[model samples]
Target: MRPLSFQAVRSLAAGLAAAALTGGALAAPAAAAPVHAPGPVTEQGGSGQGARLHTNTELARELKRIEHASHGRVRVRSIGTSNQGRPIWYATLGTGPTRLMYVTQQHGNEPLGTESALLALRSLGLGDDRESRALRSKITLGIVVRANPDGHHHGWRYNYDPGADPEYGEPGKGYDINRYHDPAVAPDDNPATEAAVIQRQYAAFRPSIMVDYHMQGRYAFPPPDGREITTSILWPTNDDVSAGALRAAKQVGVRVHDAFTGAGAVVSQYPGGSYEGIARNAYGLRGSASLLVELSALPQERENFQIRSAAISMVDLARAAASGALAGIDPARADAIPPRGPSLPGGSAAAARGAAPAHDAAD
Candidate 1:
């Protein structure tokens, strides 16, 4: 790998320093993933028709709207509060053996996921569509619409914990709560209160499938062999993910990608294996098959479009999982798992070059 330019190193150091001063926490030790180069697209709004939720108060208002639209069929609760005292809300839908949990807005700037979730709830409750009714009949869905209120309110990434440094740019909000999935860091060491609440929810609820929705960084990671879009199915430690779960993850990934690619969205591949600091990984450790859906964070104005597409994709996946289509997926026919290490844009070729390691959470 080429050495980082002096200016790049200096910028990184300055960003790290700012994160330290801004109350962000240091992430646990792990090899860093190579950053992807940025894309050149401009931003655009999505097809949804509603004011976006950009603050805690707006989030609350949107939740109320969903509840009202659902006629109380959906139960919304406060899982916990952010460092800034904003409530982290969770909504429960349906009651089936298959539990699918979704967390959105782990990073404040990526607010569209939350909006999409709310919109999805509205569609489920009000739309008479075949997909909506089918999903309502079979699966139990839990949603954490906004996980980082402090950062969101400040229009930053890290919570206002007074420990994290913010100089590392977008993901460098001092501490990354996504990385605190281990039980050892639980109950207190967690910097974002929202993360702790999510941890507790996973332990208590034990959903069979989990999905974390977030916007990607500036760059796009295209799939190997020129695939259009990508979805990452993460394997947690226990190796408890059932054959059914794996099939479901791939089915959902492929279906979502197809929808986006058909709509002219840039698609990419995200290799699936062990991963850490992510909600999907943490939840997977406890026996759930999890997929982390990342939408490229380019063309700031077009984020809304990405968010809407992702939300629609999520709803479709939920319906598919509820209907038993995903559960019955055959793994053998799915796309071959990328060789271990970096296969996507910005991935580490070194990791891909070696034998695939036992699935670890921090990969």
Candidate 2:
């Protein structure tokens, strides 16, 4: 969804942005601020190398390009080093009070969301436009596009030293890097390096909402008659998570869902966050509202016609937060997401191509 409209602030937003930039009316953004100044969308677009997935070299080069293209509006920071010594980076944008952070590709093999984040950067280059101002003037967006560069380089699910190969059962759920970090869950498997970098971002950005993105194969719930879910969303379900935080997460989760469904993605509510070890729950423990969205891996070859609905939802959700609609989302409505799904409304042209009947395991 494009969001209701910025009609209310269309007149004043751009001026406020200019004045904020010139007069320093806004407080200093976090250390990892936006790297580019809102300008022309860089020619080096999307993940540059589609479908093939990016190697470490390719990812590094692109991040640098995004930084340079920000024209100084965005800030790029090397928060920490990954297990293989890759620089884990973050880019910040916008100047609004509502802090937002997007972390993608935590599972090395799931690169779709990372590509989406890159595409989002291209859109963020709009300078002084009313809608752009509406977003930048109301929110601060931070992004960590590659949360698992090492694993991503190895083209495996886990960020293990040498990484896992799909040929061998991809052992330990691709090390299921998502399940580590919180020592309380797995002391032996905790990924202190990557986890620490994320914790640092949490402390500095202090986002009210954070989203972690991933991908899976086709799956359905409620068994026989269940809906085919191309995307599944969930709020942190850690027992100790406060109601306020849970409510906030639910609100964001639902808004993201609505945006995805509105864009015609086959979507569903995730089976609840039974695992506290996941990044969303871990961040929730830090007092920020957090959630995770699992996108169904799509055919990477066709780009133009195959707009990944999950990616569109991700971008729209950020704009929602920027425009302030996300904050008004009802927790009750979010909670209403059944264990199975309401499924995708039929006949929408926005649906992803090649959506198969729900089968196989949930990715």
Candidate 3:
């Protein structure tokens, strides 16, 4: 891919700076700055190959298309409005007793997962296709295509809340909807109106599994046990690494690794050895198995590839979860897989040294 435009690079830098000044914790040391690599280039538009979605408008249009195409077999609902009043769209397919929730685009700038989700919806025949029908026959699917509309529209990471905190810094003023861990703040202290509605929906739905899609820093990291693990899945909080969550994560990881590896891409696990705390973990707190799929983002062009691979991975994971294939994976072994190389040096330690504090709706 062509070098990122000066403006695009500058925007990214600014966003990173803003995040540092905010309340979230940083992962790297002050001297160790995050680096950006050039991304690969690919033709734009969906020319009879896999579909490509890059913008909110396109995502919305695709949702409408799926709704129309499904002919009432699938139902689309507006869980609530974003901070900016944009509709937060979710599509529900099937009516099985078990409920599975998939969310993408919680961070506005990470749009690939959202696109992949749209494609998945269209491909599944909106609950009519044989595969979807079979899966739906066993489980209900709830998908939220975009979680932070305000950030998406502005291409920023946080929601549109403008209330700054002295402890968190100026950037912390806007509500990072993902940080609303407590269910007691106004609408449970969630900064985004849309998040509030979705939280309520999930509480009512009581989904068995929740998957949140996102992109990570571009630079590649060493895998566990000196082996590469592409498509890291953040394990939930349960000490039971062998639990259903970990099993589902591993199955999903294998699928993503295969897809990207086939396409000539290297995949690996998070070097930390276990999943970190985030919105996905929060979901886990509520008795649901939550998985956070983090795609590499350092080489920006890879964003598109990661998005596609993630979509494929999600399909495989969803199918397995629906079919009870993931029932045997133990949560205790969540980090059972070892790293393939020397661990990348960054984490809460790096955050303490000078890396910008973590900021974003998911913080």
Q: Alpha-carbon error at 189 in model 3, in Å?
A: 4.0
Question: Once superposed on the true structure, which residue ranges of model 2 sit more than 4 Å away at CA?
Answer: 1-51, 162-175, 183-190, 221-227, 300-307, 340-363
C-alpha lDDT (0 to 100) for residue 39 of candidate 2: 13
lDDT by candidate, in order shown: 0.54, 0.59, 0.53
Candidate 1: 10-residue stretch with minimal lDDT: 23-32
- The candidate with the higher lDDT, 1 or 2, is 2
Candidate 2 residue-wise lDDT at 246? 88
TM-score per candidate = 0.68, 0.72, 0.69
Q: Rank the candidates by lDDT, best first.
A: 2, 1, 3
Which is the winner by lDDT between candidate 2 and candidate 3?
A: 2
Where does model 3 exceed 4 Å of error? Answer: 1-54, 126-131, 164-173, 183-188, 221-230, 238-265, 271-277, 298-301, 330-333, 338-363
Q: Residue 265 deviation, candidate 3, in Å?
A: 5.5
Runs off by more than 4 Å, candidate 1: 1-53, 128-134, 164-174, 183-185, 188-191, 218-248, 262-264, 271-275, 332-363
RMSD (Cα, Å) for all candidates, in order, is 14.1, 9.4, 12.5
lDDT by residue for model 1 (1-363), tens: 122245543443333233222211111001212111111111232112232333466557667765766667677889888776778888888766778888887765455566567656654554446755666778888888878766566544455566555222233344455656655567566655667878988777888778777554333233454542333333333354455555556555555554444334555444434544556555655556666665554333454455445655666567667777664544443364342232334332211211111232132
